[model samples]
Target: MNARREGDAAVQSYRRAQQRLRDGGKDVSSEQRLIRIEDALDALLDGLVKQREQIGSGVAVDVAGHTLAARARSRR
Candidate 1:
């Protein structure tokens, strides 16, 4: 998906996760919430990368590597 759509999805996911926490919802466990949050973060980062590319920015971001590192840190 394009940056805009991806960003929108990420925003929605983030809101959902936050709402769950605020409402004290127990349908999803902490681990599941962490995964959802990570997924949303990845999507947001992907959108940023795409936006940079579209704007012809000289900067480059390794989304996959960053995400891998984050996941590793989370597991530790």
Candidate 2:
């Protein structure tokens, strides 16, 4: 599957796991595990955002290159 979809799925799974832990009880161990999962999820989301921004910037660069080439051709 695509990167966006895969990331979404992972986020959903982590959220469900967190919810289950919360519903179970206030056990210290479970809370600690939940915190770790949350931290991981945050890192994964940040990475995905960075990837998307990079992809967008790359596309922008490609468009700018094409525009510049076209301008140069028009001047010739």
Candidate 3:
């Protein structure tokens, strides 16, 4: 799917997650909320990555990999 469509889906997913935490009788705690946010963000990232791949845009992935390798080498 296109980036806009993927983004829309991610937004919908985020709303659903928020609703789950806010629904009546829900027992989600602050820590769980944070985890949910992280999970949502990861899902959004994955969607974005897929969109980039579909569009044949590899610059972002290449740049991320280069930065990651540089950071890893610096730590070694």
lDDT of 3 by residue, 1-76 (tens): 3445655665666566566445444477777877767776666566566555544435555677899999999999
Which order, best to worst by lDDT? Answer: 2, 3, 1
Error of 1 at 5 (Å): 12
Q: Tens digits of per-residue lDDT for model 2 on 1-76?
A: 2545555655665565555445534555766777766766676666566557556666777898999999999999
Q: Give one clash count per candidate, in the order shown.
A: 0, 0, 0
Off by over 4 Å in 3: 1-26, 57-76
Per-residue lDDT value at 31 in model 1: 87
lDDT of 1 by residue, 1-76 (tens): 3545545655665565555445535697888877766766665566565555544322223566688899999999
Q: Model 1 residue 33 lDDT? A: 74
User: 2 or 3, which is superior by lDDT?
Assistant: 2
| Cα-lDDT of candidate 3 | 0.63
**Per-prediction TM-score:** 0.42, 0.61, 0.42
Give the poorly placed runs of model 2, Cα more than 4 Å off. Answer: 1-28
Candidate 2: residue pairs that collide:
none
Best model number under lDDT: 2
lDDT of each: 0.58, 0.64, 0.63
